[model samples]
Target: MTRFARTVAAVALTTALALTAGCGGSDSDADAGSDGKALKKVTYLTSFGNFGRDAYAWVAKDKGFFKDAGFDVTIRPGQGTGGVIPAIVGGQAQFGPIDLTGGLLNMGNGQAKDFVAVAAVQQHTMAAIATTEGNGISKPKDLEGKRLADTPGSVVRNLFPTYARLAGVDATKVKWVNGEAQTLMGTLAGGSVDGIGQFVVGKPTVEAVTKKKAVLLPYSAVIPDLYGNVLITSKKNAENDPESVRRFTAALLKGLEYSLGHTQEAAQILKRNVDTTNPAAAAAELELMAGYVTPKDGSGAVIGSLDSGRVAKSIRLLEDAGTLPKGMTPDQIIDFDLVPKG
Candidate 1:
């Protein structure tokens, strides 16, 4: 099994042991319920294995937002967005914070029609094409005829066609080298591939592996309507447990706001939960991700607010790129009511 799978299994085992030992008391035992009852237990699955990327969730639990909301929340590391959908659908998790593109693609293709986005955490796409300093690849157009380390089923690979279209690059000519996620950066730094499509949040990791600064060409510059991480749950959960969903969204947004304002403290909180050995790097990653949770879009929307127009534009963009089927409206994929109001 992958390291992420092992970690998740370990956490599950520990939670089971704690529950068996009577240490895992319900929320009522801690006076966290609204009606003198135990708060509901909610499990959140992340999109990837990176602990640094999931700082908001860790901060929420650390700062007692979940407790205040009457929830005994547990956060687990995920293998990928692709695996996150099934976990939620199969009732393994109550919610998932995943790539919006993956959710949209799955819903649009009728793979998981019940899936809906509760709130958008990142306003813009963080995916970018990174090249080593002397690779001579500075722009999207430069990617033509060059080799890219592509991971199958990755959001970056899924959205590359749309990105290429918007950037006016000929996608047909680019050479894609299928590479494992763990080895992609090493392969790129070793001159095996000219560039790699990954999230800018991973810039520090890339630099550490390559021992050199990497140039980033953000996909958002080409596809401005693109979005990033989102809080997702099935329609059944939203409809059946509206109050619980509301509380969870509010608590998560509270954590996001705190993380945005206090990045260092948030990173420290995250470090305690995940295997992030480099405190400075974790802080840097959190700082870079903070601006994206709620961008300075003039819409006046708060942290967890979702703009209908932007959501529509994103759907249209995906449809145009053929990633999503035409006529698939945003309402079919996103439950706007689940987001907290201003």
Candidate 2:
């Protein structure tokens, strides 16, 4: 079998679980009805803040796509992947928009056995390892032995270790620190850490605070496993509530389409959805996110469709780098049937 076929086969065979995540209880009442008709409630746990999920959150809520799709979608933000899977597995939510790599690792570790990936949101890694220009960490190699701050167990956490190893730098050589999204710039400014893994959206804030340019560490360059935020539903949902899964994914894809097509309007929506403390950061995030918007060909067909070939490459890279265990194939972990085939 081809490598891609092997991966598909592998993901199909795995009996993995998801990590149990915690979050603020969103509407403890399970029977909350939809706007017009009583539709099932679907919880979507986000790994980032309101600003991070602005694209989907605003477009879906403001555009009424979720309601139109017959879902009372509830949005809940999380600190990281630690809260996403549990929010779903523990019945706090029905879906999680989380880091693909962390979700897979959690599955392998048996924290959430029933979770399945439904759709991919962004097409690129929207994060970077920012450093001050004067700090002398100009190139990727300069990161060796530097104080690196990152949130442990986050997507960038898994990505950067592998990236460091790939860059010929020992992952153990650098002092890796756990950091929060709100306090990363402060950490860098205070010299607590020489470099930080920051989202592309926060680049402006980091630049403004430190007066230094950052060396972006694009995941695609080092890790073949660079997958954007993914929509995941429990295996129980996939089997028993396929309709809800379909509705959620369809609505989210609609939101993504609208977000990409209406840049000006989407930006405005983003502004309202996020807080005022980081308007510039939020705007920069949206602007930088433009680079990741999946484009349509001349035939008017979106190219955002799942690439099984890329998935296969990701599996191999993970396995080769020891991020994943040996013999873990794509099929055992992934369910392409949940994704739109056409």
Candidate 3:
């Protein structure tokens, strides 16, 4: 098995019995953690693996943010929407990050998350179809007859029909193949695919691997109202154990804010935890990601905050694209009372 699979399996095997991660108890009812504190024990999953983009979780654990929040968090690498959503809903993890738009699409497709979304991870959508210079794809129109690759349930691919309509590209003319998250950049580098579904901030990692300038057709350029990653937990957890949700969200946002501010140190921290990590590459990713994570709506909303109007617009866009069912509201996906307020 791949390291990610093996890691996830090992965690599932070990913690499945020990963890009461879902909405099984009250805030005061908890278990003893490693630090000898009666902190609630929960497993958390990052949307992707241990890339710099996901370092905030490790930061929360490393900097004692999780501990201070009165919890023992076991951080695990997730395999995108397909992998993470089921894990959170089925009780393997108590919290996780997911692309907000992708979650909506999943809900529309009849895959219920059992009521999720607690906070926003980024203020904007960073989904994009990225390619190298020599691939001859410079614009949306250029993507016609070109090949693309991404994991099966990636938002970049799931939301493509809407993006294509907005950008005036012929969505059906483009080709797609399945790829693992860890190998998408490699496929692009090897010229096996013209482009890969990637986040805008992934340019640094992509460029470093392909040794070429990365060209991007960012989904946000057309689908502006969509939020990026959003924090999610089971409905029972949010409704019954709200204090735990609130504390965990606060500590996680603290880590995300700190990681972005201290990019180099955050990268070093990731490297320290994951021996294969390259500090420079990780730092570069955080630097590019900073702008997206920053609130550009001029509403002065802090990090991890959500906006209602923007979310409604995203839903309308999805409905127009026929990927989403009608009457889907933001409240069904986001727990506004738990997110940061402006």
Candidate 4:
């Protein structure tokens, strides 16, 4: 062959290799500064599918919060505590959300240890059992003999037995069927399931999709201390790249504050990125969630502030409920030093 031909082949091979390497691996080589140079690429997963309840993450990306923090974020749908923890541990994703109660349960049983909670997204647990008007479900006891659809390993599904015991419902009587995160509400709308696992904020979306008023049974009503969603990252990232975690957590909470304050705009921002999101429904969900996003009392604590005392109490609550095993400390799951205080 000719020298020119060999040179051309070499150039093509080099170009192909560069492109492949760029897409395949994480780009964590640069300083975790907001200088906007050599942006570190990372993957984030929502607490669930692209529902309005998880809109803050999208808002962070769309509003340049992640970018401003020197991150090139790729957001994906999460399957809840069961799925997000493993993904972060396995290096498949860098940041995500998971229900704190579920996280505690996982940590208590020693099934999870490689991920840490960085920030609280919603101060109160929003897990609920939702159905339309015709579902004959006005209270938890009504859930008996009903079918519910939800993602496997979802917080709602994992914590239901505890919720059931507290609500005086028969856990064994209700049936839980596996459904994709994106399609759970649709399954409810189509009447394939009597109910769908949801957040209290999801009422508006369920109503819009079913064109019927939604009936909700919030777990918070019975299990008061559970936290809804908390931002998380792998232990390696938290230890080796503490600055990145701090920056990412700050940006995400900023977006959370912005989304709750400006619901319509936040909803439109979410709708722009995810076509399945309805602006009006998204806005309503955000509005419903506003009360749950901050300090429930008049104390004026910051949105993501978490108390070790409260978390310890939460652990005991789970232990009594038979969901979490004995002996899980707040330190096992939370990084108090990294948590936002101001």
- Compose the digit string of candidate 3's lDDT tens values, residues 150-233: 889888898888888889999999999998766777788888999998888777778777788978888888887788889999
Model 3 regions lying over 4 Å from their true place: 1-36
**Backbone clash numbers for all candidates listed:** 1, 22, 0, 0
Give the clashing pairs for model 1. 28-38
lDDT of each: 0.69, 0.60, 0.77, 0.76
TM-score for every candidate vs. truth? 0.84, 0.81, 0.88, 0.88
Error of 3 at 293 (Å): 1.6
As a whole number from 0 to 100, the lDDT of residue 16 in candidate 2 is 13
Q: Summarize candidate 2's per-residue lDDT along 118-193 as a digit string, tens digits.
A: 7766555554577777777867787777888876756777666667777776777777788765566667877778
User: What value does the lDDT take at residue 46 in candidate 4?
Assistant: 73
Whole-structure CA lDDT of model 2: 0.60
- Model 1 lDDT at residue 40: 77
lDDT of 1 by residue, 181-216 (tens): 445666777898998867776677667667788788
Off by over 4 Å in 1: 1-36, 177-187
For model 4, what is the alpha-carbon lDDT of residue 72? Answer: 78
Worst 10 residues of 1 by lDDT: 1-10
Candidate 1 vs candidate 3, lDDT winner:
3
What's the best-to-worst order under TM-score? Answer: 3, 4, 1, 2
lDDT of 3 at 295: 76
